[model samples]
Target: MNRKTLVLPAVVGLLAPVLAACGGSDDGGDAIVVGTTDQFVASKDAPAPLDPAIGYEAGVWNVLRQTVQTLTHIPRGGGAPAPEAAKSCAFTDTENESYRCTLRDGLTFADGTPVTPEDVKYSIQRVLDIKDESGPIGLLANIDTMETKGDKEIVFHLKTPDATFPYKLATPPAGIVQKDKYPAKSAREGFQVDGSGPYTMKPEVEGDQVTKVVFTRNPKYKGDLKVRNEKVELDLFPDAAAMGKALDDKKIDMMTRTMSPEQAQSMLAKPKDGVKLTEMPSLAISYLAFNTDDPAVKDKAVRQAIAQVIDRGAVAKSVYGSTAEPLYSLIPSGITSHTTSFYDRYGEPSATEAAKILDKAGVSTPVKFTLHYTTDHYGPATKAEFETLAKQLNASGLFQVDVKGTPWAEYRPAQMKGDYAVYGMGWFPDFPDADNYTAPFLDENNFLNSPYRSSVAENTLIPQSRREADRSAASPAFDKLQDIVAEDVPVLPVWQGKQYVASLDGLTGVEWSVNSSADLQLWELGRGRDLPEDGVQGEFEEVVLGLDVPVEGHRG
Candidate 1:
């Protein structure tokens, strides 16, 4: 999804001065109101930010998950792909090149129209046909063609063996839309949804931006999910401070997506009477991406020199505080096939090593380039994070970097145009797999939209890893891919984040609300008994404050 930006509990002892008000809703209502800092921008250059074929960010997917129905989905406690719209799905060939699915009985769209297998085929084909550069078409690149039988069965023919195809189908990119409501050849503009998922969406728009989205239970939804609440109100804010204020004012029932590190630290230190904070593990990573085509950083040595000099620990500590951990690889720690290739190759932050690399390549010292970042997307701390990175680079006396900040609306389009020599971006995975980390960044048609490309990694190692049904067995290929990324220095890993959700004490299922991929499963939340001040009694066990809890069958 890119920071699209997607926190840790080890430094729990840290203290912050400011403390916000916290309490539960006194109205005792059945509906839930949640606050988030996620924003979607529609402009002349890039319109239809929420269209399944056009939207690719994590925030965009978060909204699509509740309204759009995919054939397969990751269950509450995530593992393999489970049937959602389809009754069942599996590979039909021994080579894993052919796959098939059968639709469930009486499946209907949100508008009460019957959902046919042709709709599934049409939705997928349109994404490939539109081929928007900023869209999720890259995820479906392996699909050669699709065929449907009558109204029930659908089959997919793949260009290569891909066991991960089911996981890819579980993503919002494969969200099934009614053929009549959505155009076949182009993206449907405006803020609206027409799918057969668990929720029926009603969006509130201010100009081109979606200010709020109201989700009510879809009676026509026939999926694997159990909707706990009748309605959910997702309130979008401009920044973290405003979201926190809404939570304090009791305008929202809970706050998710992002709470600043300082706020989390303060809440951890001082317990509030009716507020509970849950920290969940995430497969999200923030990194620095290089436009290899840009003149400022075209040389591999220049990229390598920046990689050697910048200190990740300092950026994580000073900017993020205890909410994050320094990452040294493209793949995060929890995922399979993770390696410390960058750390192993570069050792530590050293000016001498950076200078030596530049000198060896006959390049000039004090390398000058602009580092661009988004102002409103990741969080308020993003400004500080980029400034800290610039300080680290400048302190080495080997580089002179000018830091620039733009809102996500403009930043993303410019990034796709290869306007920035060095830019900051974050990724929340489409699924919980190492391939999600590798393929999206290193592939020929990468999500970064940068000129960076590795022929061996894209053509050989990535395809080799996907061929294995047992993902753990694919570690060797992924390890080699990580090594290639380290050698190329196209993107430098900065930090791996932990997901945190702050909720009222009267709310249930906070731990299970966000999945391993950092996607919100709001259907799990319900009104329940007032939780104890010290801990929450979850459905499975007692979850205490400051302790990591499992979300979707995996520990955070």
Candidate 2:
């Protein structure tokens, strides 16, 4: 998505009531308490949801981004990677295979230990060494080796010429950690956070689930971001309804990640007192991924037929309302080389067409299969979205679809194990590039851990695209890659989402707090003057207040 601000439609006569209703709270003395539906569950299979090397979900990264500092980070207004812990960084070789970085003078961890090139090397190395099935090892698969040039410089030798490597380093997965604090070869268990970022975290855990995390400004920090809020508290909720209620009761300064369609619509129609809604365009997408090895959907025709019958528009309208739009390609609309490949191939939802494809492949009628989705991960609408999908497929009379809902804790491991014939997943980009959308799902060592693979995408196209220093010049390769995904139908695109952040009228930097990718930049949030009782004097005008950040960038 382009880094630009968006203005919302003006709501006539609604501003006065909203401004009057906006009130103030002195609950956590100068601390901003933010509410979210994002959950972090620590299970036996995934014991360390907060460990940088193991946790790969958006919620985990949300916490990690606040505490762990990266060598390079996306700047506040969403541009190219800027120096964070490092004083400066660049690729040493013309091949884009050898990258180097020089750390800032006197960078130290939260515990006052000075950061070294060795610690940076160890942090990157451990991610590869641990290689957790559900972790972000795929993001670093291009690295051949790492070397420390001096006390402050670190060099990475890549296996291939990957221009996107620096963007990967900007992600939380590549977050720097103290070599001694984190294990060398295993995921560190528990919810403790130790890094050199802008904040110091203190998490409150119940059993394995993290309920609340309190963040305090790090006095020993050095980075690009300015810490606007001295203290921020993130309180977790089970679903959007609970989160919405918390916002209504003045319990939280803001509610982000998700607000249900009904809640968003109601607020938009009749503005709630003291609350302002900011809607930002998102690169985040929700889709269905097939377990290609499973008997039910192993055949390419079976997958294609189901893809043909899915009504993405209906799913977006009926389930998500204005918060989402139907997505037609593996790459969603705002990205560099987005295409309507699915729409071009399928045209529209057609039962007859789907039946013909199934018959041509000699597939059995009423192709009985189960569709699985996570209950709490995406939003309250996910269950409805899948149920609608099942209804759409079953209505076609070519398939008999049964819907099932599982919590993310169990759903993710099951999906990774290829247990679900067809499962729902969402993507928030690791970075703002078409390569992130393709490589992680189509590569041989895919992040999905499924049997699906395309030699064209993995070998030729992906490598060709990465070779271009100018990302736009690589569109042809990405175009072909997206076309290949449409033909194969291993994954079906559903809807592209718009981020909704509901904050009190007095809150400052709500627009700048979340980036385009939907990751929370808590440092951007702060308290500001309350809205005037007379109301905002303007037409329905929406303005992009700050940088577009991720809402909840994860594989939910």
Candidate 3:
């Protein structure tokens, strides 16, 4: 059977008090199966419309983007190209101002569009034109023009020198879209999906769990994915428990990510036979984003009170289990500019202290605010975690959290403009740099329109660091930024997560990388054994998934 026929059944994965993974066998003898705790956003909906110039989260874009070439890639060490995208990348101009890229010849889009200098030029310019709410528009704002120096050669001339230009390209927002396909202004208007990436997302079953996705050979896919499996398939689950159960039952060939930390720990303790778990340090940071712009949150007392009521440790242990660590900094440890500012200031949840902090601000009857979250963006346990936080804050007496939530679809765009007062957010690094942590959140242009609403110093430092490219010079700027973030308390950092996966034995190339944000590269995986039914099963796996999911959480 073809790749689309390989998704796990809905009954195969389920989440909740009890989780199951690797559901019923494919009935196909040789097919490889995998399980994951996350669900697909489904492609039936219109593309969220990313600005090619400004930055934003790539979301599911990563799964198929492998086929398209970028200026740089996180090559596998002792693995594939340690640097797969660009032949060699660097700041050609000493001022850290000018950036250039040289691509491998013969690289082409999934449709066979040649990866040309103009395509690269258009790709970079597209981001600027869209002016996306995410990504680094402030950084790209400096680029004066881009042109093809020659075949396979592209140059970016910045109004000012920036050493971190390469880091900007590393993000999926900067993904190379086919100029022939994507319009210059995907922001003001919808975009066509003729991307230059490795795989084109399969149309029929885009977002549903067990949806259809196929990664074909990019004859021009000279990027790193070639080193792995050529074809890729992704199966989504409503919750992690179902994903885990599927893995235990051997329903799927490999698993990308699973449910809560405790669940992950249990899987690691007694993994299903032949199933392997790969763990990597994650750049992801979890937070409770406060709308500093909110009149209620604008009061320092209320913000600090909410921050005080949160017990990061409890949230980590209760929902994440041992799979994640309590995080107090926007910048995770091991990354530069990390600090214990939040931890040092709050120490731990203290109702008495929180009350005092509010009283000192002069208005202390009791503060209340709705803690908003979304059902889809993060995962299932998210609602539980938010409720857990609400309980803790209410118990503190100094504050009361009225929990509210939206479906992920509506919630994402609302939070991007920083509209939500206190909403949950997970930050996957744009680039593995401290600057990414500080800059994206503060620059007036960042996703959360919070900009300088809370801290002017932060606004100054982000640009200060970006201009200088020197790590040492950037350090103090980031240092002060972290400290101010903690003091202002616009957003509360909760945990730094560890990337985990449980895959069947037949699967290979289960890599652990700092880049790729530890994303599963489906192309590198396939069935070790042949299907029992062969090509005749046609596409049972996908057919089953495309079926309705009962509200009772059973197969429709």
lDDT of each structure?
0.77, 0.75, 0.55
Q: Quote each prediction's TM-score.
A: 0.91, 0.90, 0.80
Candidate 1 lDDT, 191-288, residue by residue in tens: 78879998999898898888989888887788777777777888888766798788778777777666777787677788687666666676778889
Question: lDDT-based ranking, best first?
Answer: 1, 2, 3
Residue-by-residue lDDT tens digits, candidate 3, 366-423: 6767888867556566778888888888787666679988975577667656667787
Give the distance in Å from residue 122's predicted Cα in candidate 3 to where it truly belongs: 1.1
The TM-score leader among the candidates is 1
- Give me candidate 2's TM-score against the actual structure: 0.90
Which candidate leads in lDDT?
A: 1
Local error of candidate 1 at 91, Å? 0.3
Question: How far is each candidate from the true structure, as Cα RMSD in Å?
Answer: 6.3, 7.6, 10.1
> What's the CA error at residue 207 for candidate 2, in Å?
2.6
| Candidate 3 wrong stretches, greater than 4 Å | 1-55, 78-85, 134-139, 187-197, 206-210, 224-226, 245-249, 416-419, 451-459, 467-473, 513-516, 526-556
Determine which window of 10 residues in candidate 1 has minimal summed lDDT.
Answer: 7-16
- Candidate 1 wrong stretches, greater than 4 Å: 2-29, 529-556
